[model samples]
Target: MSLNRRVFLGTTAAASAAMAAPMVMADGHGKPRVVVIGGGAGGATAARYIAKDSKGEIDVTLIEPTRTYYTCFFSNLYLGGFKDMNDLGHSYGGLAASGVNVVHDWAVGVDRDAKTVSLAGGGSLGYDKLILSPGIDFVDGSVAGWDITSQNAMPHAYKAGSQTELLKAQLKAMPEGGTFAMVAPPNPYRCPPGPYERVSMVAHYLKNNNPTAKIIVADPKPKFSKMALFQEGWGDHYDGMIDWIGEEFGGGSVSVDPGAMTLTIDGEETAVDVCNVIPAMKAGHIAEIAGVTDGNWAPVNAVDMSSKADADIYVLGDASQQGDMPKSGFSANSQAKVCANAVRGALTGSKVFPAKFSNTCWSLIDTNDGVKVGATYEATDEKIAKVDGFISQTGETAEVRKATYEESEGWYAGITSDMFGAKT
Candidate 1:
């Protein structure tokens, strides 16, 4: 059955109660329990949709440590002063109101054999289905001379929130002609266009405040998402202020000294005021503890995002190694809906539609100058294969770029509302 808001709202309460009656008799349990770890775009959306759509047939528990979640999607805009931190921050009150049990605690471990999740607060939760969407965590020692301990001096700022604030503060306090260095990550990381957009935002900040400040990027990849668009914008907007060193130019061989405030590229060390080091990433620790991850990521069935390692445990967002789709907030949110439908169907015998997914990544280069890349996908036996795609063109009119930026604004507002309820 096609699930829509109107149909869901019009369904009689007696019908929903009848749908839940079978769950009680089948398992001798009051209701099938769904435990979701992570309260970001994926997990929050899944929990909300399952609870809202199931209509008391499912017990949805959301386990997230943070009360307020700051989105990493538009954080680059925050660095560029286009948005405020408050604009990116969302609370879990809406989820709780939507019939989800919002548990503000860390998920320390998972027992697949017993179908349970152990919390850091010394409690264990039993689940009929478990959804894992724990974004990303840094791969230890991925960058030489940099670790979690050095985060204060050289912030990664990849996770958003306080780290983003810290990096912005460092930029504001830079000397007039200070140098800003960035160590970009390798392929298959969260948001392919992220680090480059960050460069643009950083340049925008420095152009107004510290015009003479220099920005340098050392990237392992030969080319990045929206490479042409970003290169054009950098040249047109912030000429001679940004330097991008790719793999061909020894950009791949890099290291940092956070204490000394130095970055080494190709055996040459340069002193800098601030360093943004985005190391290689992996699935969050909880996914590994759950034994769902392959290497750095957890592989999932493209059809339902159920973990390949275990059927009952599903993975979503940056942590899942679903093919083709980039690890993006939009991708995660899209995947969550599909996963929610499948899980709800499996438990309550609801209609499950064929999986279809789509994603768009928008980046702001300068004021009213935004660009985006996006794609649509379908599930195959092997992967989530891309069906078609689109990207913002180079040399577009000023009006077009402005419209794109405005579209992103609308999307940000709509997505936040979708994840957290409208009242939020």
Candidate 2:
């Protein structure tokens, strides 16, 4: 039987009004629901892509407590005043406008059997599939006498925003010829090249303001990402100001006294004006609570980033122990897209493409001095394996370095747009 209804015979304007969907499925069936935890590089991109690509066929809810998401990538530049805090801040308004349910609340727990997410704001959300990209949390006791309580005195500033500002203030207050100390994290940490770039930025700042001040780095790793490039830059630009002590020289065994403002490295005590301690990190707390993590990090199937423990949940970014990818924002965003495509295909019967991921980490040595390393990856049965890669050479012309910096700036804009769906 066919039913015909009279339509508007006269045309007034070509327009359509947006309609709201229920918090849960209301079509008398279990409509697919995707709950994304975290809203930075990984989570935001996953949510937006799932919602947009599904054409609102799937219910997407993004759980992030903060009203604005601050990026950690260019945070080093902020320390040098090359960019300000505002430049690192981004809003989720655009993602909301794209039909994603943006919830500014923490996901306290995930009941995998019940398929419900417990929220910190006194509510619960049900999901057919869950995406967890909760980023990183520091490991206590990794740095002796340094914990959340002492963050103010010896700021990590790894998460960006206020901590970055705090570290900058402490740097400004350093006395003439005073020392600034850094205890770099071990391997399998977020942003492999981040600490080195930060050192460069600090060197740039100190050279301009307090040229007499000195920097001491106690690194657990023997060699770091972009080592040759950074070493070359330090020797060329900040000669005689920066000293790096690697693991062979007792950099790995370090302890700090926040109260005394003293750092003990290789059994030698050195009083310092400021200390930045980046402790060992693991997946965020929620992953452990959800029982999806294997101790420190969540292991996932490389094919689609599905949890090895639960097929209904997927983990992305720094929280996931994915192979051949550093825990950087670029890596997270790349992984999110592949996961989003897989999740969308599973729920909506869409065609899932072959998973291919790539990442590039760029470091600013100085204003126009920049270097980068990146690789393309393919998901094998075992893990995501790197196919090929490239890195900046020890000596590059000023033109090439400037070009690399500009490329990084463009990438920052592009990635933020990719995550937040903003025209910015």
Candidate 3:
């Protein structure tokens, strides 16, 4: 509802310190080495926090293919033309300054028995503890005739980066009165409210640039997160520009015909000028190889985010299964803090106290109009339960809406600052 001043201060200090220090590498030898695979929301946050809290006691090595990460949280704003890549993009310079060894490489697999991680560069990294937060991988066969190749033609844009750019470009290129269709993923995936939020943002773009263009959503589930609120917003805000087909309308068989650029529903087919398909997903390959994911996601002890598969391993972000908690960036960021504390405690043999984790996910229905839901959580031996939380009530007041927007921006700054920044 409001800015978190305490966390914001911590984040700012870490970022500032990182900017000051340029070349920091003492963890390669000595100290417990924590190899964090992935540099997205989960890994970045964990690495920065661990390196900061451990005080050079734990060497954090973050393996990622890219040095920069564009926040999927605000990418919808980019789609709406309210923001640019720079507004969403973040770098790992702070982590480097905080003593995190940020490696630009893809993690291929893991030798759990030996506690080694193999990279794409034909080398292996040994770690005393491994934090796998590689995020999700699209399931190839979930949709018929849809794979990575097909996606190039009709982008998913789900994982951010180039694919997101492709989708934005396509939207801009489409002529007036053209069609924009989005295929929503089945339940239990990243960003539950993302598709609808995307719909609103895209519709906002079309409403001004291509007013006659239509936006259709093909959903696998009959219901969705904030369904009532989204429908209300679409109806009152965009009028007839947006349409959604739930399970009853789509027959629960979600597939895409990439060649035709068509979506099949029940026995009918509808063509679209641009298609965005979000496929089913699972833990990243490295996590799967390490036997961290139980089925689709990695299981962890919420108290510390340590992997159930191995004591020396931890998983966070969308790759890990956090029941009752939606798979979202906020969840991942919160989990990172818990994981960082645990890593510190484990290495120092200090008593690690459980903490109440918090998360708030804001979805931009339009630039000025948005919705947010947040919860504070606590973990017990049984499971994670919400301690306190609230969603922006439907038809929120002007002040509340504005505050939510400010909070969202603050969250972005705070999260990125925390992840890349060092501990103060």
Candidate 4:
């Protein structure tokens, strides 16, 4: 199904009275309250959609710690110097104007039995329905010799804000022939193609500026998303500059010394000027606190994204293990729409259509050189099963690559608008 603003609005209107299920009233409360945690693609989009479509019938509140949200998508472009920091930043004012009560604060805890979310600021918010989209948090001790305290020395720019700026600064300060190293995360991490794209972008910067700088990637996984295409681009654009050590070469056995600025792979130590360590990830702590996560991620029903542990609670984005869909911003945004529809229907007796989802991930290798992989999905009793998919080929024409890059730029604009509204 094609998902767009017009289609969404039209479908919601037409389906409003089609459901025979009883409306879940707010139990003497004036309005059915929806509390959404995390204000990235998933939470923000879900809040905006619920508020926009509910038309004052439901109350929507979005909780986010940062007033200026930086998108993880396209952040590698910022490292490649294709975009500035401001380019990735967005304000929550637009979401507020769209009728979402945008709360700027951290969500400290969830009281599942009480149906309340406690804030770090010493208050709690009750909700008829709760949506958790807190993104990913690094798993402790996933990478030896590195932890949150060592972040300054070995920056994990995966969160895409201060860390991104820090990494860029370190890259710029590197000496002419200095070494830059990355310890790539294992599979089932956010943005499957993200780490490789970062390697490409970092190499892009080094090739233009440092010229003789080297990049070493120690990957636990044997292969990565768009591996063939990334390898071809590395040969064409950054030959001899990137050394990727996969598991076959003992890349999985890796450690780093932030204090000494040293990287060890397979018992071979190498002094590196900068190290980027992306550790294993899990659903944000709130998901675990809410008692919805079986392991690292929260498992949800494919049809409505409701947590398996609680019918009134939903999970979205990287935090959700809904099956088939990769943890990406595009996937989260798509899931948010499906979820908003279901939540609205459950709360106000609105029509809820069958859930359909789609996601496309775009990566840039060099200047105006882009590639993508995407799939369509349908909800099944078991999971969100993939239906059809497409990917950019290894040897595409320059025109095609350039067009792909332009298409990504457009998508960035469109998705940001979709999540944050008309940029107030």
Per-prediction TM-score to the true structure, in the order listed: 0.94, 0.94, 0.94, 0.94
Model 1 TM-score on a 0 to 1 scale: 0.94
Task: Write model 1 residue lDDT over 152-211, tens digit each, in one string.
Answer: 999999998899999999999999999999999997899999999999999999999999
How well does candidate 4 match the true structure in TM-score terms? 0.94
Which pairs clash inside model 4? none
Clash pairs (backbone) in predicted model 1: none
* Index of the highest-lDDT prediction: 4
Clashes of 3: 0
Clashing pairs in 3: none
Residue 419 of model 3, lDDT score: 66
Per-residue alpha-carbon lDDT of candidate 3 for residues 1-424, written as tens digits (9 for 90 to 100): 4565446444355443333232233434677778889888788888887887777777778888886777788898889998898877777777776678878888888998877888888778888889988888988788776898887878888888888899999999998899998888887888888888999999999998999999888888999888887888898779999989888877367667899888777767888899998888888888888887888888887777788878999988888876567788888888888888888888877667776677777887765676788888998665556888877778787676667777788777777666666332
RMSD per model, one decimal: 5.0, 7.8, 2.7, 5.4
- Model 1 residue 285 CA deviation (Å) reads 0.7
Model 2 clashes, total count? 0
lDDT of 4: 0.91
lDDT of 1 at 214: 99
